[model samples]
Target: MEKQHSFWEREEWLKPPDLMIIGGGIVGASTAIFYKKRFPKHDVILVDKGIAPEGASTRNAGFACIGSVSEHLADLAVSGGETVFSRIVRRWNGLQLLRETCGDEVMDYQNTGGYEIFTDEKIYETCAGKIPWFNQKLKERLGLEDVYSEREYEGYPAIFNRVEGAINSGKLMRFLHERFTESGVRTWWNSRVERVEPGSVMFENGFQINPKKTVIAVNGFVQRLVNLPVKPARGFVFVTKPIPGLKWKGTFHFDEGYVYFRNIGERLLLGGGRNVAKEEETTDQFGTNQKIKEYLTRFANVTLNLPEKWEIDVEWSGIMGMTDNKEPVLQEVKPGLWAAAGLSGMGIAIGMQLAKELVSKLED
Candidate 1:
């Protein structure tokens, strides 16, 4: 039997909105907030398939970073200097916008800096050799001087970025939810969208909404809605039981930024071994890759050198949208349908800024 909503419920609670945003992740939340703020008189609604964001928005390692030296060097080779630097600028500015809007206290942001550790001496020398060049380019592009400096960690060569930091991902998303709610944005959780057109969205529960404009901010799940170039890539992360005398703090990355770990108080959070099994991780489905898990376990022991007795407190995975060129996809797809996705893995650094840019276009 089909369920039915009351007339009052349909009219008041489920009334067609001026703008409907599908997906309650960082991009969707930020878009809703900006849209409502710009046009408060317009009715807006944000719907998500899960109780919380089902994507990388909240399921990240919480590094407030642009890129590590080796990561940037690799990216620069593939996409060239112009494209890479432009993306970094957006990332840097996006982090600033996120901090400004949410404030430091609410998100528990800490400027603990970021480090790129190297076990291979050749790779370390290659990245370190480009430090002066990178610093000069970054200074000219982002106006930040001497961003990268040579450093060391536990006998391994490292490069540190003074501006990079860490944040509490859960707190940041909660803060966005509260801000959008306070700004008159209606958020509907556990409301799975079955299909969406330019002006109509059909729900899995046989309900439908006809909005004037619709935005698909689902990131990794965008392909389930439209024919976009973005592809889903799953990442796994784990947290460990508190370790006493854990002096190591701050975000750290290795393997060309494909692997990362950071200190959460006295415990440790480590993730990213996707490159180990890229083909296996290219799905939108959420599940643990045991092979990758075993590889990371060894890495934690051998590379990170964590306490031998440390146990995993929790483990989870998130899906991130990726493009061939490592650029985001923010554009209007149809007459009234828009997409703001393909943040790659930099949603924390670039989600809100992309949202602001997307909302600005809707003004005209």
Candidate 2:
């Protein structure tokens, strides 16, 4: 005898879709939204392995940045000048797309600006030396002059990027989910996609879905689903309770953009120091490193000068996919199994634009 199936489950929920998107983060969600807008009548469904939109999209520091000076220089060395410039353009344009799609008020986007500081004199001089060239290049790309400015704050030497800002990452992800759903795309939450082939996905719950097109948007967890030229880089973050007078009011980066901290309206959110444990930080596991966590804590106390008695309100880890080239992969991994991985820690900055590019490449 055949297993019982409800009418709603057979005709609606379990029905195969024209397009299936794996991993419901910013990229996956935005892809569904864009693809539906292009083909309004197409049936699209997005599924994520977790209950919530995990990964770096909802876990990022909420920075709307186009790479810091040293970060750009580093990428240029690894990925070359042209590629770095183009990546910067994508990230910049992606932020615009995100803002326009979600609206500023909904995401709580703050144009508070960002600053990069250095504690090492050698490193400071190295990055500061590239200020002129970076300003010129960024100006050419962004239509803005004097993008990078040198300044000092609270005994820290820093370079301020006027165009860079921060947003509420949680709110942004919520907005993406709501907006995509409103665009007529269905979503399957807590659905674990265990494996994928050319046209189908196998969920761990013993269910299968065959889609005409499947796009794997799982950034860091790509290894779990398929073989891709990407590796997971884990990061840990902590937010403190509301302090009386938290002077830091904007986003900040240090030590080659690995360390970041910002004020969330009197409460301080800080993370990074993966460099302190690069070997251990390479895993995709969602947990904090003791050494790295302790380092950041000390930095908070000694350098950040947070009141010694302030308590940590919350803390967690996020996994991000990074490629050796520091470039995102938006290629057709298999015949009809296209994938977008390796955002290289810039997922929040470039995920939407990458989705747009990927959607445009598809045949309607």
Q: TM-scores for all candidates?
A: 0.98, 0.96
Candidate 2 residue 137 C-alpha distance from true site, Å:
1.2
Error of 1 at 123 (Å): 0.4
Model 2 lDDT, full chain set: 0.88
What is each predicted model's overall lDDT from 0 to 1? 0.92, 0.88
Candidate 1: tens digits of C-alpha lDDT, residues 186-275: 888899999999889999988898999999999999999999999999999999999887756889999889999999999999999999
lDDT of 2 by residue, 1-364 (tens): 7577799998988888889999988899889889988999999999987889888898888888887888887777777889988888888888998889888898888888788987777888889899999889878987879988898878889889888888998988888888778888888889988999988899997788788889999999999999999999998999999999888889998877888999999999999899999989998889979999899999999888887698899999999999988888888877778899999888778899899999998776
Candidate 2, superposed: residue stretches over 4 Å from native: 1-3
Give the best candidate by lDDT: 1
RMSD of 1: 1.1
